[model samples]
Target chain A: MTTVLIVDDQPLQRYGFRMLLDSVPGTEVVGEAAHGAEAVRMAAQMRPDVVLMDVRMPGMDGIEATRRIVAAGDRSRVLVLTTFDIDEYVYAALRAGASGFLLKDARPEELLAGIRAVAAGDAVIAPTLTRRLLQEFARLVPPAADGSAQDSRLASLTEREREILVAIGKGWSNSEIAGHFVLAESTVKTHVGRVLSKIEARDRIQAVIFAYDHGLARPHAG
Target chain B: MTTVLIVDDQPLQRYGFRMLLDSVPGTEVVGEAAHGAEAVRMAAQMRPDVVLMDVRMPGMDGIEATRRIVAAGDRSRVLVLTTFDIDEYVYAALRAGASGFLLKDARPEELLAGIRAVAAGDAVIAPTLTRRLLQEFARLVPPAADGSAQDSRLASLTEREREILVAIGKGWSNSEIAGHFVLAESTVKTHVGRVLSKIEARDRIQAVIFAYDHGLARPHAG
Candidate 1:
């Protein structure tokens, strides 16, 4: 069963969640908190598999609570719920390490699905929403400090490795990159390994991140 | 009725799409193209509501075709269809001005829904997928050039103005910012105005982008 901690400032809201959760198989509510501070404390003790977080609270909002819970190094994944579809709370929650979020008015099935998706280490939000948010933020990012200068970290990579990094940053899997670039999967893997090491990235995810940070890859650019 | 142009290298695939689309009540396949070049030409001439673009093709690829079509300033919106889910093609397609994308293996209902969404100027990908893609890219973003040094563009802003900018970058709506900062909405608007003017941003979106570029706001941070 997936143990969940429901965090909300309203008793009615908490009750509604509990009632709905009780009906679902393979899921249980371990506890509930009215605000961020208590939520953080309860999370530490319960070690729930998922936390249903409310963004707005009387004191210590959901964002702070999420940051603390994730920072505490527990295995509890956060699934933030907000009244608004697109807002700072949702964005901040994601940045705070939330697995994803759902609208408060989401259908019961969607809510349950979101919870399960978060518990399974999958993001709760759809990929399109993530893209728009990133595009909006990416537009504000200042040009690299070095201006037109190539990132020094990239100097070590061969042309093929550099290409792999760009593809990875664009969220391409190894097989996709290989197929698109006409390289064997083994060759792609070798290139990916070399690219990861040269860029000092921990894994494919980090490599993608590095490519964006260094301006080697961008979303929605011509 | 929503008019669509099918662009695929394979005749059988185009035929399948045509058969399905012709049977749909609200959608009509206006034209078909065996390659990106033909698709662009047909898009310009047919002025269809949507273009069902296949990413991989001989000669100029879908990304290039999308960029050119969008750059042409036509009313036709491109909706890229790919066999792969997470890949560079989707990213490039979005950048190239495709409204969004759908995987080829998507259910018929899902494909129809995606087409409708794209035609309506809505994104086809899920927001969660977009978020994950962005987060992955954000991780790779290089640290700010001057970690502690004040950005030159931010010199003119009042302390409150800077705070508002950061909030905007975090995707906070004005009311949310006002509530969190204990400021009136009118005052927040004024501050936003000053921030935008001082930074020479065209709008809120640009300001958010600027904040990320200047290292004022981050994707994942404690």
Candidate 2:
């Protein structure tokens, strides 16, 4: 069972969440906090799989609590709740290391699905907010930090590896890259491993970011 | 009714999509194109509400078609389809201004929902891709370009408007901001409108991006 700690300023809100969670099969509301400090404390103590955070809490709002809990290096992943569909607090909370946020009025199934997604180490964003997030993402994503294709880190990659890096940046899976390049999946994996090492990237996701940060991958015309 | 243009190189793929969309209520298949060039031509001529695009077309690829169609500024919104979940082509398509993407293997309902969402002017990304997207988003977002607190655009704001801008950046709803600042909601709305006009932001989303870019809103410690 996935354990959760509910943190909201309103006692009735807490009760409502607790009641719904208790009725669910896979989720268990392990504890409840009416403020951020208490939420943080209980999170540290209980180490629940998911923390149902309320963003507008009175003492030390949910964003702060999420940052601390995440920074503390515990197993808890935060799922912040906000009253509005597109709130800046949600963005702050996400950047502050909350796994995701949902509207407080999110349907019971959506909230539970969000908890499951976060508990499983995946991230979630409410659907209503995603379009704007993406638009900002496309807008704010800077061109390669060095506009020229001469970043020293990229120098280490062989021509083929560079292509692999670009493919990774494009969010292609190893198998897809393999098929596209006519390489065996094992060979593709080896190349991916080498590219990650050469680029000093922690994982494929970081490699994708690295490719975009450098000039290897770009939003090119068709 | 939502009119759609199906663009895929493969005959069977086009047939499948046409059948699915045709079978659904509230959706009408206006046309079909076998390649990017044809897709672009058809999109220009028909101006369908949504374009179901395939990325790996034989001649003119979906990404290019998406770019051209979006650049054409018609009412058509492109929803790209790929065989893989996290392809770079999808990212390129989004940057090129496609509305969103989905796996070619997505359930019929999912595809229909995506089409509806795209037609409505919202964006969509497969749920599986959102986690990685958000993670990279958090990582790649640059700190304030100026880093100092002295951007001229920001200088135009009054003290309260600056505070409102920061709150907007933090994703706070006007009501939430009002609650925190103990101001009337209408007063907060007026402040928000003023802030948006002063900063030359198109909407609240852009205001959030501006706030982050200007360092008005930060991921602060609790």
Candidate 3:
């Protein structure tokens, strides 16, 4: 069962969340806190799978609490809840290491789905906020500079492996890469494995991020 | 009714889309384009509400077509489709100003929903891509740089409205801000509206972005 710690200053809000979570299968309310400090302390002690955080709490606010919980490096993932669709703290919370955030009024299923996603080590964001986030993200991330000559992380890749890395960055599956490069899917997988090991990426997602960071995955101007 | 233009090189693929869209209510297939150049020309001529674009077409690709269409400043919103979840071109398409994108294998209902969202002037991204996008976004966007001293935008905001801008950046609702500052919620809304106008932000989301852009919204280290 996935365990959760609910953090909110409003008792009624906490009670409402507790009721909903309790009604669901495979999810249990492990603890509840009325403020950030209590939430942080409980999270450390309880070590729940998900921390349902309220952003505008008393004492330490949710953003700072999320940072501390993540920095403490326990298994808990903070899923912030905000009253507004365009809350400013949500961005700070994300940068502060929050796994995700959702609208406080999100459908119960959406909240449950978010909790499940976060507990499984995936991140989630409210749909309403995502478009603006993407736009801001594209605007803020400068186009990658040519890094093949300078970044050593890319130095270990073979020319073929490097090509595979680029394909991975492009979100190509092994079969797609194989089709594009005229290789067997098995061979494509082997190349992907090798590339991941050489680049020290735990998974394809990190490798994609690495490719972008190193200029291997350039965003072409349309 | 939402009018759509389907652009794909594969005749069968176009036929499949045409059938599905035809079967759905509240949507009509207005035209079809076999290639990027055709897609652009058709988009300019027909002005459909949505363009269901495939990214890998020969000649002018979907990204280029999307860019040209967006540059033309028509009402059409391009929703790019890709075979893979993490298509590299998807990012470029977003940068190119497509309203959103989806996996080609997405459920028919999901595709219809995406079209509706795009036509309504909202942006959509495949849910699976959002986590990595947000992570990359957070990493790419630098923390606010304390711009109160230099930015002409900040000069226009009164001290109270400036506080409201920062609060908005934190994603506080009018009620939340009112509670925090002991003001009426309507008064908070008025201040927020003023802040948006003073800084020339179209809405709260843009205001949040502006706050981040100008360093009024700082991401604290966790």
Candidate 4:
């Protein structure tokens, strides 16, 4: 069974999630905490595969707890639960080492799947949070103090492969890209698959962020 | 002068827009059409740079007019105007050769900018329409004939670049990504900038879409 932990400031939320996870097969609510401190402790003790965390918990808020949880070396994957307004903190939480974050009102199916996905070592983010995430990235992009080390991560690409990477960052489909590059559809397909494998991305969404985070892609002006 | 045409069933809308265009420098209100057929005819004759077409007009709606305008070898850009309820048809209009679509209630300044942006060959998707567009893109992505093409978009990346791209697609800030990649802040910035230039992406938002469109990116599970 996939063991899970519940971390939130509210009892109602904890109970509700506990019930939901209880209903799903292959998942069990092994522990619950009412705040970040307790969560950090329980995470270490329970050793759950997943932890559903809330953002506004008092005393070492979610971000702090998330940092603690991950830093404590517990194997548990954290999944942040939030409402739309927590827009400001979502980016910070990811940096704190929580594997993923999503809105509180996400449907039951989505929540359950998220737990499973993160447990399997993938990251997640809510759609409503997309704009906030964009703003954060934009605000932080200009002062990039992190130059000089020449990210060896990008050293693996060839020239044409880089061209296709930009196209992927532009949101083009294989067929549309085929037209843009004047290449056959099959060729574009080969390039895309190889690129993903080369980078070991969890998915395309991650690749997109990688492009932005590492400056492989810039925000398109409307 | 950037000659313009207004096409709408209502005379007031046509008149109002004509007056607006007349007030703008380098833009002239050259002709008006009460319906799509007339708009097509007048457009064929006047060959304006911009066409303000209403979506709900009778017989031969703005969509058909836009298609014909594109087919006729005219370089004129079509801009569709509609209500929120009628917004469903805007994407089709885009496919029909419309450079942009605006809401009737959009601020006056937005309307003017839409015109200039389209005339400049920039694709303008309304900010409010982003959710709707993504929903459409996600729904439409399923029937794509190229089943594995999504993964192929990143085929050219090195393993580390792919990891970096994934973080970028998630909308992470440079510091956060730098933390993840264990690189100096300057190094992260260079990688991100390189990713942007290499991918030919205009901005981070476009990079986000590119991630989703290619299936490399996805809605976070929880």
Evaluate all candidate structures by whole-model CA lDDT and list the values in order. 0.76, 0.79, 0.81, 0.70
Model 4's chain A TM-score stands at 0.61
Query: What is the iRMS for every candidate structure?
Result: 13.8, 14.3, 14.7, 17.7
RMSD per prediction, one decimal?
14.7, 16.2, 17.9, 18.3
Per-residue lDDT of B176 in model 4? 88
Residue pairs of candidate 3 with colliding backbone atoms: A87-B171, A88-B169, A88-B170, A88-B171, A89-B170, A170-B88, A171-B86
lDDT per residue (tens digit) for residues B1-222 in model 2: 999999988899989988888897999999999999999999999999999999888987888888889889987898989998654665576677777878888888878888988888878777677777777666545434211225677789999898888777666777889999999999999999998898887567556546645555433211
Q: Estimate, for each residue in B28-99, the C-alpha lDDT of model 1 and write its tens digit.
A: 999999998898898899899999999889988888888778778887888888887655565566656677
Evaluate residue B87 in candidate 1 and report its C-alpha lDDT on the 0 to 100 scale. Answer: 54
Off by over 4 Å in 1: A23-27, A85-87, A126-131, A137-222, B19-25, B126-131, B137-222
**Which regions of candidate 3 are displaced past 4 Å?**
A143-222, B145-222
Residue-level lDDT of model 4, residues B62-170, one tens digit each, is: 8888878867978888888887635447545655657776788887777887787677765444545643543333233322212222333356556766666667767
Per-model fnat list? 0.02, 0.19, 0.20, 0.09
Sort all candidates by TM-score, best to worst.
2, 3, 1, 4
CA-based DockQ, model 2: 0.10
Task: Return the TM-scores of chain A for each candidate in numbered order.
Answer: 0.62, 0.65, 0.65, 0.61
lDDT of 3 by residue, B25-68 (tens): 99999999999999999999999999999998889888888888
Model 4 Cα lDDT, one tens digit per residue, A63-97: 78887888888788889888755644655566566
> Which predicted model would earn the best TM-score?
2
Best by lDDT, which number?
3
lDDT of 3 at A132: 79
Task: Rank the models by lDDT, top first.
Answer: 3, 2, 1, 4
Provide per-model DockQ scores.
Answer: 0.06, 0.10, 0.10, 0.06
